[model samples]
Target: MIKDRQLYKLILSILTVIVVAMIGLQLVSSWTQPQAQSQLNLYESDLLLQASTWQETNDAEPGTSPLLENLWGDSDPVQQALKNYQKIKTSATLQSGPTDDPEKRAASEAFVNELDLRLGLLYARSGQVEDAIATWTPLAEAAPSPGNQRAVTAAILQGLWSDPPQLKPQAQQQLESQLKGWFRYQSLSQLYQLQQRQETLTTLRSQEHAAAEKALTRLAAVQVFPAIGGLTGVGILIFWLIQFAVKKRQSLPEAASTAPTIEPIEAQADQTPNTPQELAATVRWPVTTIWQVMVVWFAAFFCVSFVLPVVLYVAGAKPETFGARGQAYLALIQYSLLMGVGFSILYLSLKPFLSQPLKWLPLRWQGSWFSWGLSGYLAALPLVIVISVLNQKLLQNQGGGNPLLEIILNSHDRFSMGLLLFMVAVLAPLFEEILFRGFFLTSLTRYLPMWSAIGLSGLVFAIAHLNLSDILPLTVLGCMLGFVYTRSQNLLASMLLHGLWNSGSFIGLIILGSSVS
Candidate 1:
């Protein structure tokens, strides 16, 4: 008995050490290799611009005036510009045209920057000034040269102060403060030139007759989400209330008299395995069984995300259209709450099922909160992105990208920014990680060799997304998440890291969107 106890302790200690070491490695890796935020924004902006080019070409014929009006009038300038860029880029590349020269490239970039700036101004007109600033800050920083810098800065400041006189004084002070710090290192000649140009624009700002009129026109074209946010909150509250009510009813005397359920108690005595071989055998099947369960769960997840929406449409419930930022915020809260509830239940139930084929999955923890959450976050990031991208591609190919998503991306609306944030950062990351990394990745490690566990998780994660377009991205991310989770042995770590990566990507895209043409 003593030998068995000692053997179990040794195995647990070794696993714990390995998990911690893996987490530390991931932390170091993530810290050292931040995403190329600028490049990512460029890619997204370029993609949007390409899409816009298609509409422009289709709208050029004299007889197609109504179509052009429909396209331009219905779509916000940002969406129209994005689609224009996308179409032009894609069509030109498809036709084997020579790439534009550096000057044209610079011009194109400037156009994109201006479009994003205009969009930011529209957002500000909609009372989302903070978002506008977030969107434009990078444009000001990344202006091509002194001329471009002045143009962008003047445009930004002019937009800020042009709104209302009350808004102008505060905006002018802020703009001046920002410029002072930014130009401190520049040569006197350059500063003088920029200041002269800025003064001219500031004088124009007082008129507010053209730019504000344009901004108002664009703002009128922008659309926001309806009541989904309120509905979601109410739905969640109702779900919890019903759960609590059920438990209270079950505890009543009438309910107790009819049901003869046994209340489980913790075992006071230790129940060590009889031998080393027994201990090993006891863990193996549970790991295998849990992995199979997770596989089924993931497969079902693909259906839920990709296929079920179609079913819902057929059944008459429209896929809920939501703003990107709102969706992301809700997802962050929802996933965190789900994780807390899920792990808590698993931990409480784990002991009663020690002899069943589920003991290998650890709901119980023996580590500090920091280490555990760190492990979970580090382990989950890659897997989440990979799975989501793959799933998105699959849905796209099937013409199953939510009709609302297609509308949001393709239509001109005030909510496009919000939708982009949700898709890339919030919804995709949360669902993918919880299904794959939080469950299957850790469970597989119980029986398989560590490398095998990570590989298996990656393989399953990739396949579950159900599209070739996403396979590469998802596989790479899944492997990274598996490695971190196995190393850290903590779900919390994976969740935090995963959430951070997603949010970071969204923020980076917004920053780049400001500058990319």
Candidate 2:
């Protein structure tokens, strides 16, 4: 037994060392997290353009209300899109750097060239031909060569737009021979169409009016469900407010705390024999050991800090190389493994008392679990949204968000969507609620006030995500989740609430991602 205890200490010490390194990894990786602002900008621009189109079409009628346009204020989506592009241009310029690897250096150069190419198109389309020329000039100055397709294309572009239309004889031939493709929105054929002469914005707008209408139709189609959801939330809030007033604020009161024993065996109170047991098969063991907590932490952080990095390094995988569907599959597998490992560790620590019970956690489905979860979700909407809007402004689209948002947004196929929904809505809620509310908060409640325990657990939950941008809002969200779980005495209630919250976000990202694409 002493030997076993020493071995446990050795394991714990190693985990402590790993935890220190994991903390460092979190801090370093946080800086490189994908920003949410760029995606928001695109979605917002599309929404504005569609709204503007609707306003123009209806304004011709005698009594058309300006309600929609008024709500969004004086925003010109086209200009907003242009400004966003300029910001992107500036950001890409800042990130450009020297590289020692030939492939990396070539990739960097190609990226810059592509950005310039696309930006030049935007400039020309906006009737700034001079700006376009300037944009393409750096690439254009490079000597036309077989390997330098971008330079050759740039030279050809300059020849088409130059005042006197001067060019080497081989320049035109080089573009056709060397360059094959570019961005979907801008390419060689697109430039060629603009070659002979510049078209006025008025003429181009007329040409794109049909496409704009189609985009608007799509935008409106995708937004209908969310509009209904928001309205439903508002209705639910109103009903709850009425109940609060009529019942003197006890309409949805918190449930009585049911914290269990967490003392050492010798210090514990005697229990009745009527307790459920089958030869100690159903013993309720307190998973409150420091070692147990350390193991749980180790499982999570060790995977993130060491396992993930090693796997990616060995596989030579980079974030850019991943598609949404691929990431979804990976997330499903990784989280399944993580949660399985954590629960297994906790279960095994019970040793002689180990046994599978009907209910592993404080999840009671026989009562008002469903209603509690739904109410919590609805009540949470307005407050969470207000904070979220302010959070977005405070962040100014700079702080990183969950990479899953970006991944799920870009995915639409049935299999990938299902995988994502299951992982997020089902898997995440089950594991997180079981760990945080079922174990952590309940254990804390044995010592602290219910509210205090909830608050601390909520804070920890928010920080666990490792997103600075999400910390405040998620803290609020986590508190609501904890409150719901505590009141219902059902882990399922909190899991449902968590699932609904994530499911809502998932839908929104999908709509925005689909519309933008």
TM values, all candidates? 0.38, 0.70
- Candidate 1, residues 198-279, lDDT tens digits: the string is 6745444333233233323322222111123224434544654587697874211111111113322234112322222222
How many times do residue backbones clash in model 1?
40
Residue 112's lDDT within candidate 1 is 56
Q: Give the candidate number with the greatest TM-score.
A: 2
Give one clash count per candidate, in the order shown. Answer: 40, 0
> Which ten contiguous residues of candidate 2 have the minimum total lDDT?
272-281
Among all windows of ten consecutive residues in candidate 1, which has the lowest summed lDDT?
Answer: 251-260
Runs with alpha carbons beyond 4 Å of true place in candidate 2: 1-14, 43-72, 91-129, 139-214, 221-291, 294-297, 304-328, 350-360, 388-399, 405-413
